[model samples]
Target: MNLRKISTNLKLPNYALAIAQDYLPSTFFQYDFKTSNQVRPAHTDIPKPNFQEYRRKPLENPNALSSESVDNRRAIMSLFSFVGGIGTLYGCKAHLVQYVLFLSPARDVLATASTSVSITDIPEGKTMIVKWRGKPIFITHRTQQVINTERAVNLADLRHPETDDQRVQRPEWLVIVGICTHLGCVPIPNAGNYPGGYFCPCHGSHFDGSGRTRKGPAPTNMEIPTYKFLDDNTLFIG
Candidate 1:
């Protein structure tokens, strides 16, 4: 219906012109589309219906809850969520603690891991042997004469030289592993060529009172296990 000619003939704003371009009919029609504030005159032959007859009636909802009931439901849901989150956290913590404990050593193995001896049981100038982790540990109760003799020895004469003071925390107590340095053989206490020392009969290795390698095939002194004095009368060895 010559829509372009109609649009070009009419004077309209940019926005209104664009709308007329899209919505304008391809064929001529009787309807008038006005973009102005002026109202169109109503035809006398067409009658208007009463709005009251066409209006919808408001209906009452049978299942609608009050504000108090809605608030109570919301509060209950929030409390349930909080309780569930707290329970999950505690459950994870409990599992983590149980896993950590499962990885640790058994109680009986830990008990046998270290050895404790009463130094008062061993008389002066005597040595006592105890077992630690399936190995013999020598606990010597040195006399004043034995201590003096060990401290007086020359460091140059020993194979693996270590001073008597360096090997012991206290002069009266000498703690060492009883295994021979030459080979894995147990040494006899107070029966070596060096008096007041240990003798390994397996390889003829001699160790002085301080556990230093003397005249033998042994290359180093006897090993000193990890030890500490729990008290004046107790020795703890590991």
Candidate 2:
């Protein structure tokens, strides 16, 4: 064999390299029975397999998993939105709950038909405020005091005394709104310079027992909401 110079920087061959087959032991490196002892170049260890393949299951698009996950989130959100819509509707509707009670909406500004009241519930000479047609109607059962005064008023003393003849129904009964048309105020009944009628404190308006505007700042008389007698004693106002 030809003699060859060895690299000085490299580790000197172990004299036992000729006998060595397994990887060198630390304590064994001190012995020398020289032969070529160059180790094979160190090879780096391979890493574990990535799940990138399993994530992209066969027959599915490469990006299908991520896309489907996003779609599922949106679908869940849409289902929640539909449930909220129904909840909103259920929260808003109102209705009549009983013969005299109602399930009123939390919000105001309602459009409703006429409500009815039994005449027998109220008596002579007394005025009852009942809701009719969403407005307050003052139903006055002319006490003998009011009736006696009506007969006593002189026609010459009155501009429009609002006689029973002017009413659509019987003259003895007076049905008029409690609200003043001039400025939407509840008028005081049968007092303060009124002979026997509705008086509005807001504008000093006067309406006779028949609700005919008599004297006041108001342009029209106390409103007579549209109403019908369901029977001799029950009146429906709208």
Candidate 3:
């Protein structure tokens, strides 16, 4: 039972050397060595697991479901996923609504969207200029003679034809946007070839007293803004 000599001769592990040193029972080694050579139990002879223990048991509550079917579990999970997705979309929609409102025009800007002018301030046969939406608006007080002359012009002679009566909201008032249709230049009031009309110096466009394109490169008449007379003296323009 000399452990150092046994270990050196057998080339056993350190644990085997410690066992041989600590456990000096020769009977244990002898019996273990004999049993190693004898017929051992086959793998099949080992007791099989009691699979019955793993089998599902009945629910303790009489009203409870005994087992959840595969389909039932899938249905529950699908319902939860659908509800979660809808909630996420609703949350995103709320945030998008806030962003849309943030980009809209301010209340003050919308409030000042229109302009008001006193029609009485403009003398007869004269033109007055006012600004609306960053564009010049022409408010002309036409004399009866000028109106009669403009109405006398034939529609066939004009480039963009329209009757003089159609251009004015009233017979005395001639309101139009001052931008020349040819090149977006401002036209000179009462200075064109046509009497008491508009002239675009940039491209030689001529407009008559009714703001109709009488001559030059202008494709159409001067634009008329949305306006109405609140009273004989008050005019509202947008």
Q: Which predicted model would earn the best TM-score?
A: 3
Deviating ranges (above 4 Å) for candidate 3: 1-102
Q: Model 1 clash tally?
A: 0
- Taken over the whole model, the C-alpha lDDT of each candidate is 0.84, 0.65, 0.85
Per-prediction TM-score: 0.56, 0.46, 0.62
Tens-digit lDDT track for model 2 on 135-155? 677888776666666655565
Question: Candidate 1 at 154: error in angstroms?
Answer: 1.3
Q: Write the per-residue lDDT of candidate 3 for residues 126-166, one digit (tens) a residue.
A: 99999887889999999999889999999999888899888
Candidate 1 Cα outliers beyond 4 Å, as residue runs: 1-107
TM-score for candidate 1, residues paired by index:
0.56
Over 1-238, each residue of candidate 1 has an lDDT whose tens digit, in order, gives 2444445456556677668658866454334444477867779757866565553232133245455366666777899999999999999999999999999889998999987888888998898889998899999998888899999999888888899999999999999998998879999999877768999999898998899999789899999999999999999887
Steric clash pairs (candidate 1): none
